[model samples]
Target chain A: MTDGTPILHMKDVRFQWPGRASFSLEVPSFEAGRGEKVLLLGESGSGKSTLLSLICGTIAADAGDVTIDGTRLSDLSGGARDQFRAETIGVIFQQFNLLPFGSVVDNILLPLRFAPERRARVSDARAEAAALSLALGLPDVQTAKAATLSVGQQQRVAVARALIGRPPLIIADEPTSALDANSQAAFLDLLFDQVRAHDTTLLIVSHDARLGERFDRVVQMADIARTTERAA
Target chain B: MMLRLAFGSLRARALTVTMTVLAIALSVALFLGVEKVRTGAKASFADTISGTDLIVGARSGSVQLLLYSVFRIGNATNNVTWQSYQDIAARPEVDWIVPISLGDSHRQFRVMGTTPAFFDRYKYRRDRGLELGDGAIMNDLFDAVIGSDVAATLGYAVDDPIVVAHGLASFTEHKDQPFRISGILKKTGTPVDRTVIVSMEAIEAIHVDWQNGAQIPGQSTPVEVIRQMDLTPKAVTAALVGVESPLQTFALQRAINTYPEEPLLAVLPGVALQELWGIVGIAETALLGVSAMVVVTALLGLMATIFSSLNERRREMAIFRAMGARPRTIMALLVLEAVLTSAAGAILGVAFLYLGLMIAQPMIDSAYGLWLPIDAPSTREALVLLGVVAAGAIVSMVPALRAYRLSVADGMMVRT
Candidate 1:
């Protein structure tokens, strides 16, 4: 249940590719309250990635405001917006999440290097990383190169990275698409345990509808965003 | 963080990194090696002939006089008559005269015929006289004193007998009157190190049977009888003249140059030496220029290496961007990698130059007869190293700015 103010709020957000005639994104409204697990379900070309880009302030909406945890992303300059995102939100991608050259713990502690506020939340970044790795079901191989880990292990490390700094919101874009059916369920279990334990808001975007049952709210692309492709 | 990322990334690509570094190292070494040799050769030449006021020889160029008379480098065009040498020696301004007789060799080493006073008066490296390493000065008519290099190379002991060749080649040998080695001079790091020293009487004795530069087929002079004959040298290639006072050196040089007897040239040794160095300095500068170009080429190779790797690293930049790294951070990482690589290459280049010097010092000494002291880098050399690193920092900006633009456009999009 969302409280008086949701952790993420987007209203009447419109975005279009520059010089492109069609396939513009129009999100009427989107919100995920504090500690809410929201699965944003969308197929390919449904403006899911575009919306996530706007929400993370990588790309600004052409006509609306993106406010996260009571801070308007449009109010911040580009550099300040990046810093704000680093401190307020954590992100996970489908694959290749961790820097392959870094050790597992180094990848987990990466956010602290950029976001000192997030770093200030933890007493010791290395120990916190180790604890988060253990809680995410990663093996005791924090010093191993990230490339050496299996896809499942790499995703768990990514989850640990996302949860390490205790950010108010976590955005995972198709976080389990690389894993097998058995690994996907196990990965979801580990991810949910960490999210719930930290009381962090999660906005996980995926096309697979099977993950909907595990989240508190299921957001479909058709209900929120309207994308119209012009005839070329 | 940028440091860690750069080093980690470079460590990940060890093969390319090592190749780039070696390229830079070799170029830097070449640059510094040329500089070292240029300075060494100049210092050795400057220190070759010291304390001598003027050198008088038969009409020839000043540089030619310096070359053949002092360095024993080439054959003199003409010899000054002994009467002219005596005339100069008899002057009130002249303190001493050490007549130099050349045009002979022993085992590729030049044979310099002079009196015992030559060893006592002739100086190099500023007032440093030749010291005997073994035995004493030549006293016998057929006695010889070999320089340190000659002794070391030919394995000549104090009593070893050596045949004096007529010219630089050993084919026309003065076999009839073999000279016995009486002493060995210590090494002076000058052309003297490669000389075979004998008295003027010995030079006259060996040439008794040879007329007009060739040994007569039917004529032979017995060594015992030749030793008994008067051995006053009739002519000499050149004579090093020292004045009673430095103020009289120019007047004495002019007096010798305008001598009415035979056409003669008297040049101040220090002035002639400077003229010779001016000729050599051109080649040294050209060599330094070529080596500098090599350094620039190596740095360009470094730029190319980083640029070619930039495409593959786009995904890595995107990952950092998602991890909240600004575009500037990505740029800083690339610049850091470049600065680190070039600095490492410059330092390693100095090390390689020292290593090469250690291995090549003996060979160079033997081959060119030039002793290049393997000393520490001079101030100029250190400044050049800093120049190379600064050039690297400047060269790095090209790839860094490109990476900055790329990361900005690639904003968290993990494109393969």
Candidate 2:
């Protein structure tokens, strides 16, 4: 269920390692509509992570442009790009998602601390975080340190953090690789429920093909990238 | 928010943070302690004798004359005759004179033979006269007035009978004629506080039978016979001269320097004291250099602590980057952590200084005869603290720059 307009658009994007001559990444044209749940399927070394970095504006392309929400990321300065990413995108890492020293609630509220626009979106940040945690099926552990939480609890906390400010786009890389099959299914159900409720666009990159059937559209790395070689 | 993040990071690594802070605190304390001691030594030296125009003594180095006359340190090469002192005092330009005879001690404290004029005219620490803490000044040949340090350390009170030892040694006791402690001077935080003051007659009485630095085996004067004999001093170590006018000091100095009776030298006390200080300043400079090196080492330790943690914190920085922290923001976080630690260390160091002074004040007073005043930091000490913090901020750039580069290179993706 997506709108006609594209939320993320890439055209003629090219990137290469500094001294590597074997393989490079090239995206001729790619677009995801608003509220589209897209699964990017690729092997471990098929340039999926690099493409994700470029999409998030963490790395610049060697050529061409990347636009998010109709704004060209390459047109912005470095600091402005960071601000844009903070306001427009929410990222979830596979491991070490939460800062171990911070409490669960602190981890969820970190995005608001960095992005004022996102913070202004909500009237009460702490209450919203508690509601989001409860909605994600996490226990009442907001006061507990992040390190004290179990892996499943930590994953839910990371999802709650990623969804706190309701950023338009959420990028998760191999988020469910460490979970058991039963836990993975349960996490995916909760993730889709929240994403659908907010009408947020999602792009999850993973080597596992088991998750492809759950997404609205699955894109293969070999189809987009010219070669499927490993990066040094 | 950045501060909160930095504090959170520090809390996560409490052991490393505490070790680095302690290193910085110890070095800072050492640096400030050395500075305090150096200044205290100089102040004690400069405050020993004041308001005296010229110090006249047998021809010798000016520093040696000032040292023996005022500091009670070292022995005079030769003694000036009493006739020379009287002649100099009778001069029209000379207002008053205090003839100081040295070379005796009581329990290792120097015994200074002088008239009551020594207490009246001798000023220290800005023209402050010596006040009597107990009893009265020496009024009899065998009556002695001890300094505050002597009375406090030896537990001597007024009317306590004490034997003066000859030749500045405790082994050679002049027990034949014991002196009574008549008074004790208040603490002046100067070398004067370590002296035992006795009249010239008492000195003469003790040395009546001793000649040429030794007692004749066959001839010894009994206490009664010595008491009946004339007790006028024949020779004195040095004399402190106060001119009728301040402008006459140079002329009188030149006159005394060229006097033909015996080769004699006159030195300005202020100038000689500075010369002595110049000699002692070398060791102080070395100590300062050592302390400075220690501060540098401590800062390097801090840098190493932060730098080594950078690898472990790579994931942390990546998370910050993903949370919209710029490279400069990451750098600031690291630098801010260092600045905070060094600042805390400096404050703790000052606290340690005062605590050490509080505990060691009495011991230092008795051991070195230097009364170190515990007070606020001088401008120089403040500068040292500022220097340490500035160096810390500058040194922190090493790790901060490294973290910035790493975050940029590995954005949102921790390889390890």
Candidate 3:
């Protein structure tokens, strides 16, 4: 009962793969309220990616209840989980996460095409995409072909894709790793602008602590314990 | 949209897709081609005579009798006595008899001598009754009616008087008994189309001056003068019987076997056709087996093509996943690409078969003596094609599952 309305909430979460030794990720309780910009930092095998999978309803935590937008993620069936992710959540990943053949704009509007409800919510989806492109400093044509662009351009397109439908939650997994420092800063700046413009809750996963100060809250994967000792 | 996307990617891999299509198309062509020919041959054999109950020929295997007398493939070793035919025709169980006299040819076309009743009850095809195409039946003892192919090939028209060059001779014999061509038959797509039909007297007229396969040396008689003498045939090659009932076939066969004058072997046309087919079934089955192997290999070609492209498509899959396409969406795309490719191959295979038939039709008819009706796929054929395309789609799924794993492993980025 920590907040009036938490955009994402995890309670006594425990996740384990089949036949694994122990739970891969454990957290007694954690929550992010609406419009909060949170940063999750971890080493390579610190279960940060696993946590993201849990959050997006890709995989269910073995022994915990997780909620996004007040809907329990684990309770959703296969189809419902897909619909939930497609309509209500957008994810941004590092590196070459794009259909190489599809045009950049097509990539950005992928979620809308999958979930009809999402398409309906964003009336004039292309218009929404166009507006979001302008907000992220990406020209409409930059969404032409994703593979043709530099890493920086691809990251910006990814940002446009994540924020296009005005989804309530946006997750990014070190989306700026490929960019130079200046390009990284610029990409981060474009990302924050769109997130704030749409009032979307942002959770960016990164190992680079130097980028930590920009986020509203920071949670390290080592802090995923079943007690409140690291909550402060 | 997914189908369009898959098709677009396939189009992008134009060469690979084209090769896959060609592989499948060639296999399908072979498969359908062999199946069609085998089926057509069986149909022709069974349908050659619709109304005949029994075939009475010289003592030989039922299949041999059928081949020589009906199909005109081999020559008969013996001839049945005309007295046996007359006695059998007089039997109460026998309704009508159409005597078929063989052993003569014009340009590889066999000549058949039969009574005028052949035009009445001797139906070759059940669907089309026997009706003469031209002038009246052969009451003119020296007249002849030509098969469609004979008339067309030799350019014989009605009322054309031509000599019967006796006894299967291609160049010269029986020059004196030149008979007139009185009528021409329409194409029946059967052995009838390749035969010269004449009265039994005409067959006798040419043989009157001959004995033991040759005209008496320097002993020739004019055909017009032979009309002054006896016109009844001394003997015949075989006889086509239509009995009161199909049940009489066994009894009549026994009667012909026990004929007092001579031993005449009799057979049911349908039974003989079946017996002949069984003999050729091995060759047909072997053909089908090889074509099926071709089909399997073509499908494997599809699989290999997709599998080879799987590594390249890793990046493609990751990119699509990054685009918010789920695993199922990627699967749909891969399946669509394979199915569409296979469908194109099937269509191309059919087209190839058609074009091949059109180009080689005449050669096939003359060389193989086969006619493959170049028509649309029957329902069974359509279903077969659908199965092939679906199987292609399923085969592509093996790659789709790989893509699924790649999308998950790649998450948002393909490392390489």
Candidate 4:
């Protein structure tokens, strides 16, 4: 169902940490269409995390342009960028995604607190959170703190959080690195099922090449980045 | 929503949160307690003698006169001669007089020589007259009326014979002519509760045979003979005068101060009481300063607790940032947590203060002759509480700013 225009597009983006001139990220061009499940493969020390930071507007780029859904991210102010991130994109980290002190449902409903658009999309946010938790195969743990849940259950909760409110784009950063091989496959299957049902674009960054077969396309770090190597 | 999250995080670390809050509560209690006692002391001091317009005494500092005459504390510089007292009392504006003759003690409690009019006209704490707990007022020579504390502590009852000492030291007792307790006054929570009242005739009868602070050897007269031998007093320590009208108080004071009979000083009791407080107020301020330091220490402890927890909450902050919370939002949550904790601590502190007052009221009343009334929080106390909460919120900003910088630097990446 994707249109001709890309949902996310980047052109000639360059960034570097303030003190570290030797380390830099240079992306000539990158694009992801709607409903596309793209796996970004990179080794350690690659610029995969930096790329994700650039896309999410966590840090400003030193040069070039990054756009999401026809809006230039650099054009928005810092606070507006945060608002855009909340309303348009959902992110799942490698580990420690859920707030340990929050209840299960509280963890799932956290995004809507910051994003009014997300909150308005659902008729009943709590009911939607419960329904999403059940779809992800979690038990009725509405009152249970995230710390009490197992690693696999926590991962499912994180996925449920990312899927709630159905943002247009979902980004997963090494989400399965902590899980066993069998759990990883199962988690990816669940994540893929949810993304397909929502018709949302997915970008999963990982070092594991074996997981690339499940995505619609695979892009290597070298294909999109140029590094400035410096002496140790 | 932010408040809920702040409270939720606090609940997660319940033990640390409770410790911080308790520290703050204790300091708040101390701070507020010191303030209460200071004002309570001032109130009790001001309430000692209310109806007396002017206190006439031998030329001395106003504070000294107030201490010796009203509080029964310290010694008078000199005695007011009977002629001078009569001259002052005969003034038209002087409605009544309660002549005070102090220099002797009944078992360490002061013995005050006054007339029957003392019991009738003397008022304390806003016109509350001294009530008789038992027996009748002193009328005859060698008749004494003991105060509540003197009666209760010395275990004396009506009609009990008591010996008076020549001075406050209790070294030389007036064993020759002992006095009988004719009455006992009820508890008034003033200096009167710790005094022994007797008629001026009793004072003159006891000192008649004594010459120059001692009894003349073999010259001692019998109590019956002295009673018959003109029991008029030669001198008195001070006298409390009530004016016919409120406007005549200053006029009476001026007249007495410029009396031609002797070098005498007459002071408005309220002004003298304030002067006394001004000297004693330094100690009150010191107590309050110490208590204020304790509160600062408690708040610093709170800040340290919050600052130390920031290392552990780094990942939580990153999670919040990823959930689209701005760095300022993270900072606000931390500050909000501290505000909540200290606000609760201040409330608990006030509760503890009231409880302590309830328990210590009787001891304070009897020991210091200061009645601490259980009352609502005064405006000063309310401001103090507000200041505490505001200070807590401000101090927490230290940790909040640190967390904000960390969240901005870490940026969706959990380093630990």
DockQ for each of the predicted structures, in order? 0.66, 0.69, 0.24, 0.62
**Who wins the TM-score comparison?**
1
Can you tell me the CAPRI class of model 1? Answer: medium
Residue A166 accuracy (lDDT) in model 3? 75
Model 1, position B128, has a per-residue lDDT of 94
lDDT of 1 by residue, B1-416 (tens): 65776788999988999999999999999999998898888887888888899999999899999999988887899999989889988999999989999989998799999999999888888989999999999989889999988998888899999999998975999999998999999988788888999999889999999899999997888988897899999999999888999999989988888999999999988889899999999999999999999999999999999999999888788788888888888888888888899999999999999999999998777666677898888999899999988898889899989998877666787545
Model 4's alpha-carbon lDDT is 0.90
- TM-score for candidate 2: 0.94
Candidates in order, interface RMSD in Å: 1.1, 1.1, 3.1, 1.0
Worst 10 residues of 2 chain B by lDDT: B1-10
What candidate 4 gets wrong by more than 4 Å, as runs, is A1-3, A229-232, B91-93, B152-163, B169-172, B175-179, B205-230, B244-255, B282-296
Model 4 chain A, poorest ten-residue lDDT window?
Answer: A223-232
TM-scores vs. true structure, each candidate: 0.96, 0.94, 0.76, 0.92
lDDT of 2 by residue, B1-416 (tens): 56776787888999999889888999999999988899999998788788999999999999999989988889999999999888888998999999999999998799999999998999987798899998999998899999898999899999999998888765978888899999999988777888999999889999887888887677778888887998889999999999999999999999899988988999999899999999999999999999999999999999999999999999888888887778888899999999988997888889988999999988998778777899989998999899899899999999999998888888778767
The better candidate by lDDT, 2 or 3, is 2
lDDT of 4 by residue, A146-191 (tens): 9999999999999888888989999999999999999999999889
User: Candidate 3 or 4, higher lDDT?
Assistant: 4
Tens-digit lDDT track of model 3 for A62-111: 88888999999888875577668877888787867566666777777877
- Measured as a fraction from 0 to 1, the native contacts recovered by model 1 come to 0.50
Would you list the C-alpha lDDT of every candidate in the order shown? Answer: 0.89, 0.89, 0.78, 0.90
Question: What lDDT is reached at residue A11 by model 2?
Answer: 93
Extract clashing residue pairs from model 1.
Answer: none
Candidate 3 lDDT over residue span B1-416, tens digit each: 56656766887789989999999999998888888888877776677877888889878889999998888888888888778778888998898888988888766778788888777766665766555577656768877888777877788888887766555655665577666787887767677777888888888888888788766787877756788988788788998888898788789889887776777799888888888999898899999999988988899899889889888887677555544567787777888888899999999998988888788777666455466677878998888788889889888889878877766655544446
